[model samples]
Target: MSRRSLLGLGELALLPGGAAAPLNAGPLNGALSDDGDLARIGHRWRALATRPGTAAVRAIAPTATSLWPDLPYPSYTETPARLLAMARTGDPALADPVARGIEHYVRHVYTPGASADGNWWNWRIGIPRRLLEAALLIGPSRADRPLVEAVDHFVHPCHLAAYEGHSTAANRVDLCQVMLLRAVVGADPARAALAASALTPVFPYVSEGDGLYRDGTFIQHSTVPYQGGYGRVLLSGLATLFAVLRGTRWATSDQRVFDLVEKSFAPFMHDGFCMDLVSGRGIGRHPYGDRRRGREVAQAVLLLGESASPAERTRWRGLVRGWGFADLAPEAETVEPAEGHRLMAMSARAVHRRREWVAGLSMASYRIAHYEHGNGENLRGWHTGAGMLYWWARGHREQYSDHFWQSVDPYRLPGTTVSTLRLPDGAGAAWGGECPPARWVGGATDGHFACVGQHLYGLGSTLEAFKSWFFLDDAVLCLGAGIRCADGVPVETIVDNRRTDAALTLGGGWAHLAGHGGYVVDGPLRTLREERGTVRRAYTTLWLDHGTDPDAASYRYLLLPGASPELTRARAADPGWVDVLANTDRGQGVSVASAGLTAVNFWQPGTVGPLTASAPCAVLVRERGDGTATLTVADPRRDLDGLTVTWDRPVAAVVRGHPLLTRARTGRRLTLRWGRLADRGGSSKTVVVRLQSAK
Candidate 1:
């Protein structure tokens, strides 16, 4: 075995105990910083300390039924911070109380292994982290020895690299943080070095597991996309570590960690809002909506900028500033536009951004759970990952935040076609345990435009469908085909299940929900208005019923976000605005003439309008308003080594193409060929060609 194999991760070969002196308290405190944002730690210290009934009764009485008197488990951990805050007051009267509280914590409550109940993390990471931070704030104390020893008893040196559990991604970051704090409190340089060195595993991109991916996708719990939950934790932890370890002997210099600011976190956030699609079960938690999560990330970015390079610092600040100011001053000319589209094929998710709005689509595959349910949260998120479409607009800032998840119908989430089979709470699976038997769950995008597709297999239900969303500049063309179910229950395709108080008005075969947007549908549309009040909120729901045991049912619709009712009526009347070329089990395609874009999801060798593929693929052709045209293609199935696409349009020459694009020939028809796609991740490959006038 290699030498690295012997040492294991985050491990070191240390010399005898007399080798070097332990690090002093000053540098560690300086590294942690008592100024800047962290200085706010003591702002409310007096209130927390003086809150008469705040103490944990469980600490005073171990057999107490409630974990704490009035607070929660790990709320006792805040005692150290409260004491430190009180010490900062320099009032002699407070000193005895602070010291006694610290002694009580070290002796009674956190007395090594006493916190073995509940989650392992609370004992090992949560409690120790709070204690050490407060200790640093309070400077040094004679109580440090016992306090640090108590921490070490529960948190072992190699706990980050233990045989199993808590050894990857966010958990690893958390463990490393605890160890670093433990080192500072214990005055041990060896532990600090080991803790910093252990962070290397989290820096590199992982191929098929937890941690960040090359495509800017972050996964936790093996098969769940958790950019909003665990990703925030990873980002926040790294931001603190990067700040705390700067210029120290144990400082991390990995560029990949720095790169994540732009690559992983930035794309999904808009106007200080992170999409619910990547939030996992955290979406079901109270008061933790998209904007709240976005604000947390924005704050973390600002903190991270304190340790980032000057250029990186400026760029991150600009992003945060934009998200902060985007919704403010509506009368001003225009805010910073969220202009682009992102296709995270690795995670089966996509996002499209425009100046007026931002939209996201969530899907599931063999590699990702349909929706995660654990800790008794998100019990009804069975259809969240089955092509749930959500968006944010100018006036609809608090749309989803107005108690939507707790109130909306889980089976009728927007943009999802689901079987109305009744299921129990915590249905489907828990902790991302069950993966939907679907692999064709990705798309092709060219930064500005995208065509996403998903061959969905319903979670814990007998439902299957091929859904596609072609994102245009002003509207999204949504299509679904081959929608079949065998559960003998009604199958419905949700068109717009929105939380809005605006009256729904129908005119000219199009429906518009004031203050939100409008939708143009092809088939019979049903609407329902209801009020849900665990706090009492209103919702507007629209869907198409495919009867019981639907077979090969289909629907096509156009979603115009932030559109006026007049514009909706105009588009509904103008067939030239958007044309549905084909809607069948084998293929689905659309042509948005106004945008000069034609896209298709070919389930097999078939034709959609003038486009034909030799195998299953997603193809998008955009006329760039110039002589040149861009063609993007991908094999979402990831089972093709080669594919040929032919567009029946006269082409002059092949301009440029991807490395895998070996053949781009021009004749009476434009022909493109690609190979070497086996074992690929369904990433998009684009080729540009010079188009001649159509015959």
Candidate 2:
């Protein structure tokens, strides 16, 4: 019943190899007074490190190759480095298993081939390529040349230059590993090229400042019943990338990364809470992840040890513990034994001599960061930012900040821990986190979200917390569906208090969202009278309340991306598609023509379910020449936003505009290239050209 958590280290001692340490604390920053409660934390870390366990850590060690999870598979080969860490700690009792796990990680997670790969895997490119941090954690002494080669191979080609010669979600993971790879390997030619080339995508192509990140959102075209939340890959990826660049010795290598981290770091934390910039908002206090806070402490401790400013490390410590306030309740929280060892392994830089500061910093940081009220975005993440957040959490607080807090055994679920939502209509659907399944309907991109993938991700998807994202053009809207204001309440109208009816709060009733953004929709747009919670407007545009963060206060509306509208008319189009566009202004020509225009929202303030699709989303009746039946879509972003008219066969609609995001052409009978995002603040015109489709 110790308030302090523990990892089930039973698997550590049973390794097949020789002696190994139960844990390696990693680097520490001595940013604290020589004596005090912090010193006590240091002692605790020491005692925890010595605590017996890791039976399996030894069995998995020794193999030259990295390991991958058998069932769920692994996201990276960090598990191997994690194992070597056990051996380095000199735990004596856990060497064997630790070594074996290391072997398995390299062999399974890193190999690139159909045989070793998971059904849906980025591992071949993810594990080894990104294992540099893991290798560093294990120390250069333990990282064999093969491991290094694996790391290099994975990142250089797969991660850095995979999609369209730019960074995609997968690329982000690649880049994430690059930090550690570069860290352990030093600045070689390959490393420099990787860094420079990857650098372009990081900025302007990706983040907030310039393009460090892709400034937008997207929804995968599936058929389940979900849309991407505030971010893709959960928003955690973005933050993690920041932590890695800043934590490892690489902090000085790239000023852009450093600056991005510093600038975005504040919003990512937020008074301790780590919510998705989009949704996943939590109230109350905050909490920290075991790994992330630990990493911050490690870095802070290292800085302190190296004679860095004491204030900076101490400040980071406070922020570290503050992370654990409200979101996340990983299965590990319920486990016993090795959890303690895992925690120590993640935080204690024991071999580094003066790591006492690490213990204190980690504890304080975890306490604050972990408990912060949030749905998950910052925890597991909920946007294109997932790679960044993951890198941060896994690199630093695998035990707390990221999915490790939620994962029972890091080695158990591995890659499976991360998943995407079902296509709103049940097409090719998959999801993560916990919850009850929701309904599906015909909308813009695909169908809709499971309405449950959010909860499974621990971000309360019912509230529209977790989601995946992908981008083709600069314009994207990978975002979340809104949740209600009354915290702890569901968005179902049937459940009343638990439900946030669209008609209840009006346009952001609980959100304090206000903007003058206008959009252009072909033909006469229907206008809905505004009420308390919901508003009957032509197209549902996104509004940001800023959640009390003045810095993050920003607004954007969806717009025409790439769908070519073939036909059009008042309030609804004939048989066409609605293309989404993007802009940062707050003014444009807007309308709600049918045949392809929809709006989906994450963290939508008020709602009810199965929401009456009667208002926001309407079924437009349409037909094909041969007598096939299909539905025209309008505003697919909204849970009930799309207005569709079905046809018997295929239809060709050219949706043109500035703010388009993605194209979704999935359906048994009809294909759709719906808007990824539309209605940005700008004046625009629409040209509709109708055509028939091929079955």
Candidate 3:
């Protein structure tokens, strides 16, 4: 047997009494400068903190109650591992549940009979995700024979001869395990040397870029975009890397490495939410989830807070709070933080409270809540991976469609999916679904666009075929959806199921997409050459592209499911929208609703002509034609909750000099109500209006 064969995972090492020195207290006070910049900007953060009502007990998942092997792993089970780690450091509070967490992992991580080999389990083995995970947990000295043998087999044709090392991003995960094993086995030089040998070939995967898109920044494999929550995986990779560095002696704290990681994460922080983008028209599915891989980034940022400059701390805090990840909050409703959460909270120990109540509120107006789609495409937010690369973002990105299994980890959640990565000690949401009697799919077409660093960048698209991109923090979002084409089967839809209030404002802060991507574009918008993933060309993926070439198509109705729309008073409406071009698969003319702005060309690339035909569809006419002329189209596929329009600007309309409640205001003009639609009982109530030009 190889020397590494002797070392096994789960082995605990006793620190040499004479050799190891006790680590000292880390930076606990605020950043070095105590710069008031964050304090000032954070004034808003502090004000929003302690947001009330996030704590009201929510209804539980009625059906998911009795589900077993529920979440691949609750992650909460790692409590024992956490307690042991913490107890060794002299922290007493880490005990109670920690033991239970460990026990859970031992019991559930590998359920016998679940796999072909009674002793072996599918813990994502075919995919090799767990091998890397185990490698990260196993240190140099402690190598489980089976685990080492498994790692040996998992490594693809590479220098170290391991599939675990095949993926640069995956290797990062293994990096952590290798160190963990080393620590467990007393960090013997021999084990460290062997582990280092294995890690050698994997370093080339790290690209000079800040971060990767959809995958790691390694230049070789980055060409293919995997979207659908790939960002969360990146987050997991970084988190694992950080833990490995801190836990094992294999790596030293490198400022450059950490800086790059931080800079790579920059794009996620928009306004206050780790915004996928500021705005878009439909439920743009930028599935940057709130948890998953990002949890590690949160932890790393928190740890950096200890030694960070005041400005850095402020920035880090903003990133953490900006992700719109209330679920990760200790007080979140759907999900709660325990030991893993503690790691995140404490890591930010360097974070100083400017105000006792400052909270994180994404300046980006939840974009998905804006436009409605009947399809389930936009709902990837909760289950998908993080914007900065967390698993849930990927899960959500992949969960809604038939391709959802691509995003499934085989181990996660209480049911449906995520059973593959299940770890007894892992922490995850028990219930992740909308409260309703309906769980509908296939209504509208959804798409995603993001600009993470090359390390992780790409857009999630439902167009040709469902595909996604992550790690593109530097790019802009461009997505168009056809809620209902002239001829297409209708679908059941829901727009704002998760949000508390239904905001109908068209233009606001950064677009807040609930489970999809949204965009608010104006000015010199940059154009991106489509970087299609391999799946984009798959016949079954984009069934629409059966034989049509995108370049030759005269009119394309990129289907946008009209599920549900958030009806609010803030969004704008263009009543003057003209019918540009309407192409239907069935060659039938669709009913252009005057209420929701049937269709308008806000911005066309190159020289795509405007809708030449006077639109029976809703149109937006600026008093002087400055804002935009929007033509809206509703979901013929499904009935929308409601359709309301807000002008580009705020207007308090006065008819005969009397200001009224419901009026379309844009750019300082008097907003007389143009049109409105209400879903009283699943049926729409249409409101009509005429522009009297009171001005």
Candidate 4:
């Protein structure tokens, strides 16, 4: 745990012959601490390093090359990893098994013309990567030539300047890793240089398509927000490359990667768990839950700190410490106590982090997919992006893990208003095909607070609604209007579908789930409890039935995260915490008089409370109650030349203005105008104003 030991851990992390840590470990297991806990790392390595039992290794059919012919793709790659682990641990007793494993890989398993049968990834990167690493680890063994040549047959595509269409985002980085290892194993500096050069395209931010955007959105397959799935792979690969290639001719020079630790990834990580909303189809993968993904990210960040600048390294170390030590001790201070709120407009995602809890909102525009189902995963994620909200409170970071994905009804994910129409397995479309054709999917945020909305378009159904979420300090106020669908199925707004065994209590138009939080509803709230799936885990679901084929039906609710049952009842009884100033097709607005905060989603030229917007826009105002206020506005539709707002309150002066604010008038009615926003990609602008006191 000393500074010297921490530095030593980084130095030895990527040395040849070191056992590679498994990327996806079990939930809440394998957290790498800031002090560089070597025993934990060694324990994980030994878990992966422990070779198959004598009988299991002997079960390799004598004539067959594959260790497991019936499961050739992934099972074949495990041999070299075991061999490398044995070699690194210096186990003379297991030397023979390592040699036999290497022989099997070179002679039979990975022999020339080994059927390229399964997923292309297995043949190209998976198999060759392990073998190449084993070669580097064992240090120029006599079997290097045949090993390189055998891997060459399958990995020739990686050596190419371009990996065809497979060279983008995570796939590109994975392939580059293979190329680098192949070069080191083959003793070809030229190949290593090629690998380093091939990585150039992966560093810079992209305007669109499969890459990291400027606004911290990590997209893959050109649509799915994969900050937790493929994005993790990209970061881990980069960290390995940075470590293994350090000081070599093939070393990477792009420093932008260090910046991504905080900008592109940290927001999705809350209390040691990656938010599942952005993980796409990977959420359905067994044993790779949000906590495991978060641990993987933490590991990568720790490794990345070795090459990061001092400021970035300090920040990353604090983050890794926070994630690793979260919930370990309730009394201990965390690295980020008050993360505030963020709206990643490019990814159509928002997160609000409070001291006691964190909430994430996932929405998809035409630019992003609603959900992705491919390779037989996430088949029932039809409503993941329908304004789904995922939150975590203290001591409940494990809520989304432990068979939650398998047992909970996918149709009733919390924070989503979905139709009761039963969807077929793998419903809608795969890849990027599930995106709704709506551009008004982003929001306006002042960093500390935000107003996000989605102009809902049904997926493979006739459902449409306008949904919005106002994130405040105490609660998230949700409003939905213009709900219309004609598919002969009931439309329901799921207040929550919690995975818990605790008692669910309902009283006075409010519901509370023990150990979770509370919901204040504006309609008759329906509740149910059922044991689901093989785990027999219990779930409590709360929703409002909008009935079948209704028009213009609306819903309003307040989600008070971490609120006690008594507090929830009191808030429900008072109903003055927030006022729904308007809820209609043209506009929806809410006001918190105590906070002096008001937000509105203007669907058209309409008036809401004391504010009128002349175009479709999202607006938020924070009044100081001392004759001063700050206004934030955004054109989420991305088709406005200009937007004008007239407020009933008179303005004394424009204290400050944003770059997009073209005009501001101080008169009986304050007027503000903004222009040239069509190309701004739905980013928000803010201006401060001084309001004249009413005599």
Scored by TM-score, the top model is 4
lDDT for each residue of candidate 3 in 16-125, tens digit (9 for 90 to 100)? 21112112122111221142221121121112111222222212121222112333343322322232333233222322232233323334433232233321213223
Candidate 4 on 1-695: residue-level lDDT in tens?
12332345454555553334432222111222221222233322223222333223333343453554554533655665555655554334444455456667677667776777767787788777766655443343456678778877877744456633667889888888888666655655566677778888888888788888877888888888888999999998887676656544455757678778888889888777788877888896865488888877886776677667767776667777777544322333447734688788888888898888889888878988878998889888888888888888888867788788888898898888888888898987777577888888888888777888998887788999999999999889999999999989999999888777788888978998888889999989998889998878888889999999989999999999899999999999997779899988788899999988989989878899988999999999999967899989998988899999888778899998988889888878888988888878788888999988788
List all candidate RMSDs to the true structure: 7.7, 21.9, 20.3, 6.4
The worst-scoring run of ten residues by lDDT in candidate 1 lies at 1-10
Clashing residue pair totals per candidate (backbone < 3 A): 1, 285, 193, 0
Show the lowest summed lDDT stretch of 10 residues, model 3. 341-350
| RMSD of model 3 against the true structure | 20.3
lDDT of prediction 4: 0.76
- Give the per-residue lDDT of model 1 (tens digit) for 1-695: 11121122112113221111112112123432323222212211111222222333223322222222544334554555555455444344444455455656777667875848766776787777766655654455656777888888988876866523667899898888888767665656777778888888888887687988888999998889988889998998887676556545566757787788778888787765777788999896865478778877876776666667878866776776676643322222333545899898889989898988889899999998988988789999999888999888887667677588888888889999999989899886588988988878887888898989899898878899999999988899999999999998899999988887788999767999888988998888999998875877788899999999988999989999999999999989987787889888788888877677889888879899989999988999998788888889988888898999999888898888788987877978998889877566788888888888765
TM-score, candidate 2, is: 0.34
lDDT tens per residue, model 2, 1-695: 01121221212213332112324443211321332222222222222233234324434423333343342345433453455345435354454344335445556555433244442234333444334433333333333455555554544555555434235433443454454345334424344334435544443332111122311221111111000121223123333333223322233233333332223232233223232222222211133333333233223222221122345433433433443422222221221111110011111000000111011011101101111122222333222111111112111222223322232221111111112221122111123222123211112221211110111121223222222121111112222222222223222100001011132112211111112111222222222222122222122222233232122112222221221221112112322222322111111111123322223222222222111122332222223244332332333222332222222333355333223423333233333333422232111112222445444
C-alpha RMSD (angstroms) for model 2: 21.9
Q: What TM-score does candidate 4 reach?
A: 0.89
Q: What C-alpha lDDT, on a 0 to 100 scale, does residue 106 get in candidate 4?
A: 73
Per-model C-alpha lDDT, please?
A: 0.75, 0.27, 0.25, 0.76
lDDT of 2 at 366: 11
TM-scores for every predicted model: 0.87, 0.34, 0.35, 0.89
Candidate 1 has an lDDT of: 0.75
Among all windows of ten consecutive residues in candidate 2, which has the lowest summed lDDT? 348-357
Local error of candidate 1 at residue 644 (angstroms):
1.9
**Would you list the rank order by TM-score, best first?**
4, 1, 3, 2
